[model samples]
Target: MNSAVIRLTKCSSTKCLAMFQLSYHSQPKVALDEGISSHRVQVGPHRLHYLRAGHGPHTLLLIPGVLGFGWSNFKHQLLGFDRDLFTTIAFDPPGNGYSRPPEKTFPPLEVEAETVAQFMEALGVESASVLGYSSGGRTAMVLAALHQRLVKKLVLASTHAFILPDEYKYSRSLDCIEETWNEKEKNILYGVYGKENLPKLWRQFNDFNERILKEQRGNICLHLLKDIKCPTQLICGQKDPLTKVENSWLLHALIENSRIHVYPEGKHSNQIKYAEDFNMRVQDFLMADEELSGTNIREEDIKLAKANSF
Candidate 1:
């Protein structure tokens, strides 16, 4: 993959517009208050909506990716995990889905990550295992770095610590924006199979992309990556264009306890594409009864699981 000559024709032009409007506000699978439940909690100046599920000794938290909707993001992993083993929590970040929009400055990844900690405190949860995908990966990373005592394990999927390879400008380039816009958002839905793979879901995709573009600007929070000391796992889709597979490799190199896994031919939606494998790796990591004197979970395993049952 020549970082320079990346051809995103499939995601460029009107297709980018189509991808910008993707929405997951009321996904059928996100049934809160039962197997899954939604709640509103105060974080800083905003009221955030989060989903809760299962009830067990182990608590698991999931963070959505850039443009990621709550249920739409981790729905697949939720289906794979044995609910009896753990309790799971997923939330809509400020300005997305059922959560209130951020005031003045959009909730940066760092602030959102801190808010996640505050959210747990309000729920009487002392600690939990954290999983983050894409942009959510950054949030999980921030949690581990700042609130080390609260995170039992960390999983990062298709994630990056910093905008790396300065020469690799896909995301920073106008082409990236144009490419994402090409996909209509209305048809972009995420499920166990990944990104819904629908060609006409333009509005759904666009709305998501638009939100990330606006909110994520100057908000990536890369400075905290090296500070993370939790058990960590990293997963990457071999064919991911939005964030290169190399990003995973870079993360593994940076996070002290990190490990890496790459699925050949898997793209940005690989977590959903390979949901079973993702869940298995996560379960194994959480099952480890290691002393928490330090982060025992390795980095390579980060992306192995995204939304396992708590």
Candidate 2:
């Protein structure tokens, strides 16, 4: 079938929510033998790089934290989850992956959020569920809170609603990358962000630990979190030093209709270590028939999975 133009009703504000029409041009399903495929779309000045797996009814966008790319961070989800149930897209925010930023100051939250919305629009997606890890999780919150119609459900792992302390300044200190990291974590970092400074396609993360704090300027989405009415899930490791388990509790407290999961003995990179269980839980949450919405936490929503000791 020939690809057709996606008509987005022009909105006065560039960052309009799911305000326009999306052509119901059904995306082709991925064959069982097919592997994940890379995709690119012009989102404003940046060209976003994302990987698409599955062609199911529900759309799920995976956003990664600082020093991480969606394709690398959420690979298991694309490979392991029931793709027939949901189409998943893992994206690299501007500068992190192949999505290059314009030459100027790095963009702030509003800009980043706009990029996400425009990205969806480019792909003819009126709205989709968003799953963000670490800093990207906070971005997902902003996307849902500010652009309500654009997100159906939210899954936030290793995310927080609070801003860094005033004294927190990062200069390749890997601050946003999480200080409580192991060698495996370091390898992931080096591979994703530091591979080719000027040597090739990776340079954005070479500048800071987390670019958002320094470059992006907008409310940290804390104020509008309660305003988010979508069914949300909050996840974190009990031992994540950068974003503590208590922070996850804070998000759970503020966001109504939210569930919380704490992986015992898990670190900031627990998502990588526990991919199977983590992806399963996320899929279950997204595909669940019934989810209660309120500040009240359900017994099952609270998971305290213990990590095995070495």
lDDT against the true structure, per candidate, is 0.63, 0.66
Give the range of the ten consecutive residues with the poorest summed lDDT in model 1: 1-10
Give the per-residue lDDT digits (tens) of candidate 2, residues 54-132.
8799999999876577655876777777878888888878776445443223455667788889889999999999998
Model 1: CA > 4 A from native:
1-34, 101-107, 165-169, 172-185, 188-223, 290-310
* Candidate whose TM-score is highest: 2
Tens digits of per-residue lDDT for model 1 on 1-310? 1111111112344323211212233232223223555566777776777766677678888888755666678777665676889887887776555453431124555677778888888888899999888878877888899899999889888876544433134444433333554343333433211343322233344443456446653224445666888878778888777667756765665576766678898876666878998888888878886533323334453442211101
The best candidate by lDDT is: 2
The per-prediction tally of clashing pairs is: 65, 2
Residue 290, candidate 1: C-alpha displacement in angstroms: 5.8
Q: Please give the distance, in angstroms, between residue 134's alpha carbon in candidate 1 and its true position after superposition.
A: 0.5
